[model samples]
Target: MRNLRLTLAWAAALLVAVSPLVNAQTTSEKNLKSDKKAAMSKETLPRPKVIIFDVNETLLDLAPLKSSVGKALNGREDLLPLWFSTMVHYSLVETLSDDYHSFGEIGTAALMMVAETQGIELSYDDAKTAIVTPLRSLPPHADVIEALKALKADGYKIVSLTNSSSVGVETQFKNAGLTEFFEKRYSVDSVKKFKPHPETYKMALADLGVKPEEALMVAAHAWDIAGADNVGLQTAFVARPGKTLYPNADKPDYVVNDLSELVKHLAATKTAQADTESDKTLAEQLAAQAAKSAKRFPESVRKVYAEGIETVRATQIEESAKQVGDAAIDAELTNWNGETVKLSELWSEGPVVLMWYRGGWCPYCNIQLRAMQQNLDKIENAGARLVVLTPELPEKAKETAATNNLDIVALHDNGSAVARKYGILFKLPAAIVPSYRDKLKLPEYNGNDAMELPLSATYVIDKSGTITYAFLDADYKKRAEPADVIEAVKAAAK
Candidate 1:
């Protein structure tokens, strides 16, 4: 009862709504005291600072769990929010009682309680399976994958700090196709405590060998931000419901409306920092090379080295901004697929109609594919080979092709590496994050877990890789008409 009171007190103090949970472990109470002490050890380490993440309400999606409950309760869609509140409440109860309960158990208990509250009849086993299965396989928000990729590329070490057991978090990470992005996943089971507990946050930072000041904490819950702030970690709040404003005691350093906004903000920050560092490094390298050349030859080489440095700087700037040469007319992409057909090679044989699509999840791609299918005969008779290049996983790519009933070859362009080489690769905008999640509901990129976007382009390439005709659409929804490609093919053949 004391434990329950402490748990409720903590929840009420933080204005955190919560549900009930399973019993705690034998050693949890003793462990909690040690955690506070353990967290006080602020040691700095050698590697770049690690940013610790909160998993469920942070990186991983709880929407599936909530959605399932809402459906189970017959439009009492608010059941999930209530159940989640109880889950957190019980997690604290376990910690205070010096006990540890697996997140799965706590989740089960919470679901049963929520069901009882709603006067719904569900057997313990049935309720547990319904809630836990989806929780275990919960997807990450769409923006999460891309945001992590950008951070990884920018040299930030990423880790997940969650109240879920390590096994639970692992299952979730793997299921969400997010195993690669996280350098480490720490579960509260390690400390036998949940967040708002300074020890839990401390242990995570300690393991990563980063000072709290150097680390940033991101979560969709206000309690998480407040707890993180108490322990001195900078927090970014992602406004998940029932998590109100910080209690005036702990304020987040940044409050974003959604994961998309957080991702864009982080990307811009990293980019600016990178540009600054790159400029410094470039200046130093040029100066050192110039000095070496001056020492090597007092006459001719000095001017050459100076000229080389200038050329290098100019090259960098041009490469940064220069668009690819009319991609349809030049820069023929080689086809490595075993098939004897290549996009450019086909053009010389007759005419080649190439489509650059963003893979199957895109509504625009589907609409365009159906249109292309409608004009298959016209395309073929015009002496053109139709090919679609996408960054989908091979199986998914094949499935998408089969579903579209396409006669064209669906080529795999995994990593968008081919598109990048062609200067068609661009970072996805944060604005489109919801479009991918709530709208298109696409699977993440196979390699990086980031959302994939392609500039829907159609090209007519000749046998020599020279593009004869091209269409580039800035709006992904509107594709080049099959008639347009057919006309281009006929014109090229003539």
Candidate 2:
């Protein structure tokens, strides 16, 4: 009886000693859960120093390629999605099997697989030409350019991480008019792994000199976001149409319907974090500059400029150029002296520098004309003849040449037939037509009832009638630098 009582006393002592320790563990766990909840609900995340973008679907619109693929499949448009899914599936298979194949190869294989399933015969060459060729020339999403510009202005270093081969991405960006916005182009080719592979994201981080936490991966695919999240990087999911997040994957730090929405969210977050006084001062400065510029030009002229900027941004003018190294069309044009000259005839003598200008009324054109005149001697020394093409009438061309003292031939492209041949002619927007006709008397200068203009472009054509170099931009104010033009001429001469 004595021993039993001692044992009971010891048991009671042990319970008293363990009670506070158990309470402390429970309290600690509760605190951890509270902290996690706070993080999940946090309104602001630490801003990323670098933003890595996915190239396909996220930036470039692949919808146009769907039509080409569908046509190849006997107009079965429904097969496009299946083909794309198979391509992605096989790419992952390649990664998992420790093998490597170009994205183009995998895509072609996927096309063949889909064709076999449908009992359709498809040649590898035909499939690649029809489907993969279009991938190089996909157009950008409508909001991509503006959103990228905003992010750049807000001081974010943007880079592209794509599964495409290096040459493929280069051509893609060049054709999509998106090459200028990205700081660098990264391809999974270097690492031999497709995306969702940790190495692919790690390669981007290492190349960009950014820590995982300091970078944000922006993608349209939920798998991409989950991959980035797994590696400790922040993520923004752009929920493109017909896309959904992976049900089992961790949620991204931010989610938006599109890139434009993401830009707005980032802008708001930035404003919330920035110093109020500095932001106010910067805003006032911008407003003042805008007011000054608005007052400097007449209302009609301002409207024309505004409309021009908008139109050019919305149009795919950059890709309209005839591909480089193609034969230049043998276009007959009337010079200022009423003499007809064929482009081939000029090329037979030596290399030719062909330039397109708006008219004498345009200050930008005049600047470009004078700049070319200054480089005329150098052009001749490099064994090239300089010829300027204008849609203006012969009389207007003569006046422009005489006014600028330009000795180079100024050809009158009467109805912009030569420009049309070069695939650079575009009708003036309705919004700017009235200002051009009534305010600037454009019809009087061009001798035409219709308002049409060629894009401001310059080309260096070799003796073989091949276009060796081209500088084409829709913005009237941007012209090819004289030095670059001279260098191109010298290279063409060689």
Candidate 3:
């Protein structure tokens, strides 16, 4: 009996000793899994894409090229256009064929071709120095500094990219007074290849510690945009006058005519980011509710409005337009024509088309009015009355209407008081005011000399004065097309 009890105690001691090892193994496994999960959590987090600006045509103005090339070719400015065209074309070819060449090489080739055609004395080295040196000294576009400052203020890490070597890039930035505007400058020198070559872009991004998806390449060249887009980098095309966009091919995520437009787009994108987060939160709430009551309802309907909130917020277009409609706008005073017309009075019978014009002095406004005049019949047929509103004095407005041959009613909304109420009026920048006053010859606002109304905005207001459709573009050169107006009118009719 003594031996049996001793053996039993030994067995219990043995079990106790082995049990700790098992528990230790289990705890170690649990810790390993937790560490793995933490590592994965970091890996899954998304990083912000680096926004890269192409230094040449995007931020810098190349108008100096005309005179520079004219001198290089000995008084033939006509050869200027062809040189730039061929330079861009061959650059793309070099990249597309998986071959890399410096921008200087392409520029030399283009200049030689132009020299041969024009019978000018030019050598490869001369062309290279002229093109590359000018690039190092070109001025930033008028809107560049303000726009860049705004982007930097908005917490976006700005980068400058160029086919030039890092040395060349630094010289360019220093000359343009833009050195402080960029966090970093990426030159193709490290990769020893020009852009459009995936290696060049990839290496630059890798150096920045960012992935291609988290980067945006801004350029004025369509091929540059296409190449950037191909490699998974978002693209912004700055449509400078000498440069154009590829409308059909791999379109850029954003197209802006100038740097200011890009800044505005970025601001809008920031707003959209907030909107998207709100939408995601709403979706999460709905999903949680759906999970709670799985058996009571079918999956699809339950998924849509599963929460206590019965209404699913959808983007309502014409419905929202009809609900608020547009408010009746009127001038506080009448013109020399003795017409004191309430804006709503015109729309009561049919849809009233409203156009805001700056003045006759504005070439952009003139072009827009001409476009509207051309589509007068279309406007009339759409059961809409066309009215042109201007902050200009009555006489100036009349002169503008006569010059444009507009049959539409002209209403004078002096000082843009009505415009201020509608949230569209803004003071002209100090820089633009002097240029507009001296160059465009526009008179000052009645109340405020420093302020002026915008170029033009067209709106389709329903009979109830609610704006069914509105076109508000800050750019003067662009206007709502006749087709868009017709569509808005038809949409309102339905």
Who wins the TM-score comparison?
2
lDDT at position 140, candidate 3: 89
In candidate 2, what are the lDDT values of residues 356-436, reduced to their tens digit? 999976756765776677667888898999989999888778766654446766888878988988988888888788878
Candidate 3 residue-wise lDDT at 276: 37
How many clashes show up per model? 15, 0, 6
Q: What is residue 38's positional error in candidate 3, in angstroms?
A: 31
lDDT (Cα, tens digit) per residue for candidate 1, span 191-227: 8888767789988876754446557888888778867
The whole-model lDDT of each prediction reads 0.64, 0.78, 0.66
Model 1 residue 312 lDDT score:
35
**Runs with alpha carbons beyond 4 Å of true place in candidate 1:** 1-48, 71-75, 240-243, 267-494
The lDDT of model 3 is 0.66
TM-score of every candidate: 0.46, 0.48, 0.47
